[model samples]
Target: MAKPVADTFSPSENAAGYVSDDNPVLGFSHMHDSGTGGLPSLGNFPLFVHPGCPGDDFTRCAYSLTFRTTSRVPGSVTAAPGYFAVNLTNSVRAEMTATQHAVLYRFGFSGDEHVDVLRDLKRPDEVEKGVPYSPLVLVDLVDLMNSRSLGGILVSPETGRVMGEGRYLPSFGSGKYDAFFCADFKGAAIRKTGTFVGNDAAENPKILDGVGSGFHIPGGSAGAWLQFERPTNNSLLARVGVSFISIEQACENAEKEIADWHFERVESDARKQWREKLGVIEVDPTGVSEELQTTFWSGLYRTLLSPQNYTGENPLWNSTEPYFDSFYCIWDSFRAQHPLLTIIDPIAQTDMVRALLDIYRHEGKLPDCRMAFCKGFTQGGSNADVVIVDTFVKKLTAGIDWDTAYEAVVSDAEVEPPNWGLEGRGNLVSWHSLGYIPWDDTDLNGTGPMSRTISRGVEYAYEDFCIATLAEALGHAEDAAKYRRRGGNWRNYWNSDQRDVFQDPNDVTVQTDYTGFMQPRLVNGTFRYHNTRACSPVQEMHRCYYDTHLDTYEGSPWLYSFYVPQDMATLIQLMGGPAAFVDRLRFFHTSGIAYMGNEQGFLPVFQFHYAGRPGLSAYFVREYIPALFNASVNGIPGNDDCAMGAFSAFAMMGFFPVAGQDVYLLSTPFFPEVRIRARTEGKWSVIKVWGFDPEGKKKYIQRAKLNGRMYTKNWITHDFFLKGGTLELWVGEEEGTWGTKEADLPPSWPVEWADGGGVGLDDKF
Candidate 1:
């Protein structure tokens, strides 16, 4: 059985590094997911050192015994930005730090005897008793994360360089791909080296290739080993670089990034890079606990994990355009993650937009949830369109080919790929024909696999709005009118007859009513009942219903009921005006239906401002920071999903971006002062925020001032942010009616779609 380890709160297998406060020391594995849940990929190689080996040479070394120590090590593992260290139970101290594409590791041994280095490419679950750890270095080419190996090779052992390449499939709808690696042994010389096929050393084999055959178990485990000479300091440092292209490229990456491995220089440079990335927004950490400050930085750190930079790593074709993969999924990111990037790093955002466009040109569609060079199951809609539009609309589309980019968006909106659900808009035909997606197939016994038709209907509506905005920007008025009209199709799912009635438990006299909830309906207009707390007459409607119980994606119908961001005015009116909407918001919060952990309810926190209750928005957002989040390993409630990290970053900075729009909702910041370095006129400009009484109980914003004048509303425009200015907010102990007036509320665009040159298309573009 596999050894017991502490729960590291990591759900994805491709996690970069894994740790738990009290867990036993599992050998540090390379390549890990930040925060995800699925059959993970990329725990590709784990390195460990074993003492008291049976053989002195690689050929006679035992290959098949477990290397993990039986007992757990206490208080051993420590992790920081670009660094991780652990002292194993076996008295081997290992420390690791990373660069952009490579990692440098140092292993220190306590015993004076010669030791063996073990490289296990086996899946975590596949580790078995009596499995050989022989051979200096083993390369298992067959077993990968939900992948079958096509081919692999380990070159003849050289003094300081060890190189290998394997072609295998990645996880979850990903295509087959190649992984090439090159490692540099800094202080060790190769004394022995050998290759193995299915657990036995290959006899007189100069080159090992082809599918596994003639082994005890065909295509079982194949690898190469290199035993190194003992070092003077009882330590060994290795630098490894990996690429999907070629071994030469891997070596180049290491040479360019890590160069000569002065472990401290690489480690310091890695930490410095992280500091520079997080340094975009400077915060005065005074008054907040160190833990809270760490939480903010860690959240920012998690945001950069995926949509990995694959610039020169695209295996299919060579292109100068920036290429990125491991989108993991864009639906989880387009909301806050990409928007946050627009504010902090416009250059990175522009490159990301270009990368998405490049993918469209090469693969014939924008990547939805891409991994391993292939499109996987799409979560909701073509959210990459939303991401591109969000950046494009913010005027961040400079230097990008706008015409070609717009064509890609139109292709996704209009064309249907063969596997519509995974890559392109399969349901667009139904959506275009019917105002909303009419449930023509589902609604039987709820066994429709991959069915989230109602959820998709709402997502499609928002996506249409995104396209409409792009259309308006590009002077395509007719296209804008058509898509803008379709954007409001979210109303079709709003069943006015369905009411969320709240009554006083002790006294039946007091009660409240909230109407116009999202209901599942069929093509024939028959309402489908969900087995939920709210829908079940026998069950007390206290806890929120899971999304799966209703015909929604990742959130319940009640949560989906508030999913309308493009037309919040209509949503407010649909919920029975501002007072009624605020009351319903309170009900959702008090009834445990408001899941603050996910993207579904992310925007609702800002909707309070739309209700002319900016102080309440500030209050709730402020309290939520320290309450729902922390600085520990389990700080995030669920999958970072990139969205949560972005949200947390925004929350710390005292503002939230209205996705796809230039507007930002205001809130009281956790810090006393914040500054953002804005890029303007080919230089960095300063955007400063000063809050009076930031650390005290007087945490409510009484009023805000822009420049030297009093700002009426509770928000700022992206143009103002880019131009740079001073924003000052006065705080007090009690809530003040600063942004409570209806006229002071943020602008809510009308849902009506006006055709025939309403936006002056002839003059704009």
Candidate 2:
């Protein structure tokens, strides 16, 4: 597993750095997404560390306290989904807590004697250790009950040496796509009292040791320590709050989550939260290698971090102005994370939509990417369209208010400003507005130059179809028909002779060059094809470039073969009928052009399965799963958004809950016995494979049944899983290999208006 990105909590000197088995990079301060996207380390948490003597890596040169030696509790220590904790021999414990805006770490070290004294000192610069530590002294410490807003001191039994102490500060972050929603929390400095000391028995220090009171640590490691207890009532737990609001809001959150418990109870509850979430998907595979299983669970855990708890009765943290709290990876996540949310947790899906709608109402425009104030992710096309379209398609909005969902979808699309730059002009949208964005049109407003005009036409046409689908669902048939007809807008950009999607035939000879050949040069790797400017019909900076001898976007002629979704029958006919379509799909699948990594490729890859090619999806899954198994490290997949990467992992596990429709497509399994435990339900759903004919790679599903009944249906509806149950399958490597005598194909109903134009709830993907 790649090292967990270090924590952003102010990281004082700890050890040679800590590495949690969950994700090694995580144990450090300044790590981004202690459980999600990798963010830069900003040194948010600052604790002082007294250096050990020159020779001491551990002993002679020591930190502020005596190092306790033991394995930090795993289940006892949760990380992410907001909490963390570690058991120090079950006596001395540590934990961290987080709200949408801030984190508070609470530590508990049992007092050795009744007269333990909490010391107040800084990192001694003139150390006897290898290197001098940052010199800083405790300015104040508070006892919660009495001077709830102020600081006080401690007289605790001191058994361990003092490492040091300091406060962490927040600074503006560096993210190009940071479209923020947090209300100016960016500039609102983190107000942690300087050089603060935390001990149990300070004056009026909140005594959390009563009955049911506790503290919950964040799921990520922030670092912790404990000192001996002392007289003077120094055995109380000090609450630390970092606030975007006054220190007051932070205190409220602390008080609410931790009123009666001391350190142990709070930490225990925090760890339990993680165990509950991770227990979502239980695994039981006998043959899959250990590496594969480990990687598998690790990736699944990563998906559980976003669209988290944000709605508080106070509403400050949920506000969009100062970019309240909840954030999402819009650019990268729409393709996967959003879809995953629909399946894994529809309620969460609704809430995310709800928060977004809230933002839209407050900000006047829904964000391209959700953040506090600035757009920190990146801008692209009608992502909101994809999100809602994909959402409604699968009926994931069952629990959400449809009227509101429709309003959000339609309203967001209507208000979306026409895009600029590459995506706007690329083949993802229509060119009827400007024929085709000129490849060099970045300098202009409406028209940007495009590599292939057809792609642009098709993309815009696709979005139009999406909008019309929603409009039709709301009884706007005219709007639906208009979009449906416009969906064919890409024909204008296609050059039949070139057999690919591209700009209209222009007199200006296009320069067919490569972005990899630019200068001494900007080394081209994954994005070399992004140099669309050089493909101008008219040469400006040099020669107008083309993607190949063909007139097309970055896609090959084969890929552009059958991407028109609305008219699949025509698409199948265009490819020469069902059998021919199947053959072409096989060609694409076997060829490397079936790039699952991109947005456009998923449908086609699955189209092969839908086309009824025996074992095609099974074959695809077999190859795709192994690729992902070898691809990502732990949970991090270095994609623009990690969602697709996670999706790939989800698929490889043998079942892809197809988006837009509530069906789960069965694929060949990497593991013989697979158990997928859902997070929303306490039930365990298992898929068993048996009765297979190894010969000819039999993949034909024959006589499929659910439970004990003889059921034959290709599409497994949402209702099929109302009370989650086991789905058993009998497989074969060859066609007609299973008992085809009784096997039934998926039910194919008449295509309704809702399928494309949003006429009814009959949406299918």
Candidate 3:
């Protein structure tokens, strides 16, 4: 659900605390991605909740959930996803719940009097533009983005009137706001009305409407809230909040997308759906804390939430009605999200891959930014190469012949060239082919394109490493050796004097006096050159690349530094010592310069645990857990692109494949107690904990056991969490004497990484 806690419209929705007289309570809506930079949101409600008092302050209300929601439910109770309900002064213990697609709401009113379960009768329809840009740009933009327009086919099969008001609120960014189709729609009487919130807005109880009944949904973007009235007995009041980008599609949902009925039926269905997806990982966590539970589960929520049903399988995919899905920064996520897909949920990942691959087959390549059925024409690189290779290396795509994946990956890399998504990318084929992409590789006047080639040269090297490692594991020695040489492409870019990673020419010695056009010095700084003390700009552009677009890029530089995980050892040596790496990571965390409040520098913050600084990772988990779990009121700080944001939280809880490889790494705990309801395939197993006292401090896991058996490694394999498992981490406030070294972080050989053994294949030639 895309509900925003900040704008819960209830008392304590976020900072404003309680509801003000100016804005009375309406039924809480669910699901929404914050509309920023003139972009739009997608989500809708499933019910209409009308409290008798139209304009009463929240303080006067009977039931208030306050601010007691955790990461799993970070929003206020009223802000919770699916079914969100609360008590009111009007004699109703209102509650709501959502089943993957449909919602169930039950309201317990003061009297046995028939309450409203009406369909389309509460709020009537109209046709015309809700508002326009320019003068009302800020307000109307939200209206436009959240799919709110005043014009639509309001055909009445039977004559009747509905009541409701509309409004727009400030968007999170500079000039934006969220639009809504909100209204009480309740004049007074209940039971007599049959109001069913569906895609086809029906006015008469028996008659149905279709496409002609749909509206403009200003800005050509979408997101809406439907209030579904759930009838109840005695005092159990329930109403489901359904949020969606297309009210038309939302109406089509229950009948098609997410259907069926029943209370536990929906909840059980959701659980079953989640299990099918989560069961891909067989994680057996030991000594988990309660905070981790919320953080991890919530994190899981983030990953599974995105890249909704977007395009279709035909040529008409882009123009279809349900064409838009998956919004976020692909530049950052493509590095890990796509790779992580292979390890956690191969089935869903398969479908996702097929979707992107289809895009490739049709458009000659995949798009980095596809928003609302349109090409955003955003940043690019030969990411499709990286994605496909990582999948083939991990052997994740089932059903698709491995040869198909291999051919897709290899052929694309050969033809697309480095920085494929960037303009004039084909020019660097030779340089990338030879390993390092030099500054003067091809087109000198093509500053942006050449720079990207080099950057992608570095990224491609990463994929090569994955491929090499995987090949070696599969006994393809010749292939492994060939790719290993290719993986060393980063070496060609290394500058000894600069002690920096630069873009190199096909020949290792060829270099050029390059201009950092992408991140023109804040004043007079160099690109990846200065080692002593960098001007703020270097750090700012690490995660994000500032350019012709605007000022700030997606992520900060602090977070970007540590992403070269393959060279952690070399980076350590270059930085002077492991102690230096520790110091830098600590700086990132303590200074707030790294900003864990967002997702950019996410991986760097936890580098401590990987570097034998268990105490450090532990301290971080404890220190920053609160902010991480509650980073969103909308859909995460920036773009979730689905559950990638959630998985970041999941990884934060001590388990996740590092950089999307099948390597699991564990960290210290932020909370004293954590619990995950374990279900293997379909059978549920009671997961319990004891070492996490809920009173421990900066607890570093001293020991771990899987199924009560002690294990050597701190991380789980990709094969684990997916097949149903449990992890019981022990809690302590200090580092263990058995901390592993950074070099030993990810197994250097596939044989040694097969879950229960080690092989002497370090640096095999």
Candidate 4:
């Protein structure tokens, strides 16, 4: 829960992307959202450390973020799973760790003896022996974006305890939220206490309350400070508890969770929690490189960093149901991250599903993205439908209210909210009538950005398909048939005449062999011409964000066209049978069109499995693993959004999930053996490779045996994990015929749409 603090040298307060090596040290805050794009989220109430202002003068202390910013000692930054440490040029070293709702920091003040001697020599009268070492730490009332609207801080003069609350805007959504913090210090006596506004700090006023205008001066800083006497061991310990409820609750949360004031104990507890969460899946790692292992574990670590557990901290409504925030965006996580969690951490997944249903119970619509107790902008479809159905298909039914879950997803399909950009689906009337979101469809029911026609059309189709899966399970036959037909709406956006052409840097246009893509259609039922490669990395990469008028969201038609996950059988046929489809898919990857950075690029990496080329799927998994996803700082190609790590972990573990479905496409694992402890039966499901290759060759799967029987299917079901078994794969240097037969392919929607409605895959797997 403790966020590392740094002051950006760039123009904006949140520039340099959270914490950077170039930015100076700003102090540690108690809350943050990791691996998210857009403006920064929740770096509020940061507490800065100063090793006693020069000459023991209170005014000499740097109270503002600008004046207090100190360069970090080069190469001194160190971080681990639950711990972080860094040395500053001010001769102060800061180390921190955290509990669920509280953070414990140990600030060490090791004065530079040589610099002290030089100061004494230069001014003998002002500094008799050496500079005083009284440490002064302050808690600022500002956030990462300085978007504070109303804030107040109160410092206890005798105890040096600071309590504050502020209403600030969410990083990526509309409206504001209230956050509170309580900070207490140990290892030092309170010498004095006061409040500061900007650089002017005084000891007279111990309480400050103001609106946004009052704190908008020079540095946009206002907070309370506690000056302490020189510690007996030159170190001070500060514990901060944060909550969305109230300052009293924040203090209670801190005192209840971290009453011992033991930094090592807190750090140890944090590490233990992480180990328990990540230890369910164990890899042998015998044939894996250290870099690949680091990539796998680090990616796994990132997957758990968000959708933070704010069960009781939610102040918007009181409910006994579990509440989780920082979904960040379900559009990103529903593809992989939530699926990964459904496998390894089903308990958390169950809680998240319950939380979504609870949100729908109060908010009237399932959120597409949510954080800071506020609604975030919906990136594409109501993808939370995918998350709920994925969990239901995997059978994570402990405390899940399936009745409410079905109602929520049906609301997304049949009803339109007033503001569809933040929650639920837009253009519902057209989605129901025209089978696609037209580029210029006029929506009278609700308002939102009239963009992402192609991307949203495919995503909404898949979402409806997911709802169909749940409806069939819950015995809602009519609802099941209706949504299942709507699931085929992706076929409406298919412009058969659309041709893809590439333009070089010299402005020469060259047509390609591939034809037909999901193009934007106008309200008049005529397809509008949109470049097939417009939003791809090789073309206008920045054209498809939240506010863009582009037809796709963060992807090209080439990528979205392959996003027909619910009906890959038809998609493969439309792209020209298996041979042509394989050729086009290979060209999409080998050419510069495919980018592994965005989450949309993830599924296509393994789409070859649908074409009966499971070997090529294995080939591309190796291609992107250590290439785009690795162990370096810039390892992830794009905004992680927690999905990058999920993609890497699933790829390295020898299987990739088709989200919202029960299918897991099989491949050769990077490790010799991978065992996952199933949450259902509490038994281990093992994937063991026979011919292990440490030199990185022999990745193609030649044959496979499940529970000592011949298994030729290219995909496995969630039941394989629910009921434990051993899946043994023998590898060779080339593709083999084990899972190449047409019947061995993963289950797909029928090619022919029947009026009575095609049967869902619920009973097939």
Best by lDDT: 4
Candidate 2 residue-wise lDDT, 139-215, digit = tens: 11111001122111221222211121122221112222110000000101121111122221122222122111143
Residue pairs in candidate 4 whose N, alpha carbon or C atoms collide under 3 angstroms: none
Q: Per-residue lDDT for 416-458 in model 1, tens only?
A: 7766656766556556655555555432211223356667778
Better of 2 and 4 by TM-score: 4
| lDDT over C-alpha atoms for residue 195 of model 2 | 17
Candidate 1 segments whose C-alpha is farther than 4 A from its true place: 1-30, 52-72, 114-148, 158-160, 197-207, 211-221, 441-450, 501-512, 531-550, 681-696, 753-765
Taking every candidate in turn, the Cα RMSD to the unseen true structure, in Å, is 6.7, 12.5, 11.9, 4.3
Q: Rate the local accuracy (lDDT) of all candidates.
A: 0.65, 0.40, 0.41, 0.85
- TM-score against truth, every candidate: 0.86, 0.60, 0.61, 0.95
Error of 3 at 347 (Å): 3.1
* Reference-based lDDT, residue 622, model 3: 56
Count of clashes, each model: 16, 131, 91, 0
What is the Cα-based lDDT of residue 131 in candidate 1?
A: 22
Cα-based lDDT at residue 135, candidate 4:
81
Error of 1 at 649 (Å): 1.0
Cα-based RMSD of candidate 3: 11.9
